[model samples]
Target: MTRHGEDIGRWLATQRRDWDRLNEEQQARLGKLGVKKAARARKAPAKAATASRQGKGGEAFQKGLEALTQYLARESRMPGRAAVQEMPDGDIRRVGVWLANQKQRRDRLHPDQLAALAHLGADWAR
Candidate 1:
């Protein structure tokens, strides 16, 4: 006779196709036979979580900008240079260059970054 495992595997292949077409109540019936309903797919987080995450991201970006500002002020004696050299992290240096290229100090940051700065109650303009 055929092995039980092989029989179950064969049965599952056929059942899986029908599983997709089955209604919730029909799918529940299959659970009694040791066939679980397929786990529901994962979904994106709710709007509140997204907003909270963005808020946190903005705070982090602002902190990085502030630190870069302080480092440039102390080491380079210039806040806005077209190119910054010899910084440890390349990303930080790139941000410094971008900041330096800004025509106005207030225009240095992205809108999201500005929003984040405001959210943290920081007045960088002073």
Candidate 2:
């Protein structure tokens, strides 16, 4: 919804998000408009959350590497950007897309991750 060139939905979302920062008069005005403050979301501790995410990401990367290894063994070459392959374990992976994404984000990868891919003859991974 729009009102006088302002996006009402987006404005309401922003108002709710910044509810705590609103002065009493502002809050009253919004309250009259039936725009309530948004509920605060609970979050895990940063260290634990980061560690958990890292663990999951590492596991996923290992799975992708395994899929890539099997693909290399069969095709004797890297998969193209649009190629998809079935792993020995029967998982269908878009290995080519995965590789492309990895190559694009190589700068963000850990040294060990880059080394692993480089070892697999992925020159771009180096």
| Candidate number with greatest lDDT | 2
> Candidate 2 on 1-126: residue-level lDDT in tens?
899999988988879977998999999998998989998544335334534565777787888898899889999999998888897678899999999988987755666778999999999877
Of candidate 1, the 10-residue stretch with the lowest lDDT total is 41-50
* Cα lDDT, model 2, residue 69: 91
- Cα-based lDDT for every prediction: 0.52, 0.83
Clashing pairs in 1: 80-100
Q: Give the TM-score comparing model 2 with the true structure, all chains together.
A: 0.56
Residue 42 deviation, candidate 2, in Å? 28
Off by over 4 Å in 1: 1-60, 63-67, 73-76, 85-92, 100-124
Pairs of colliding residues, candidate 2? none
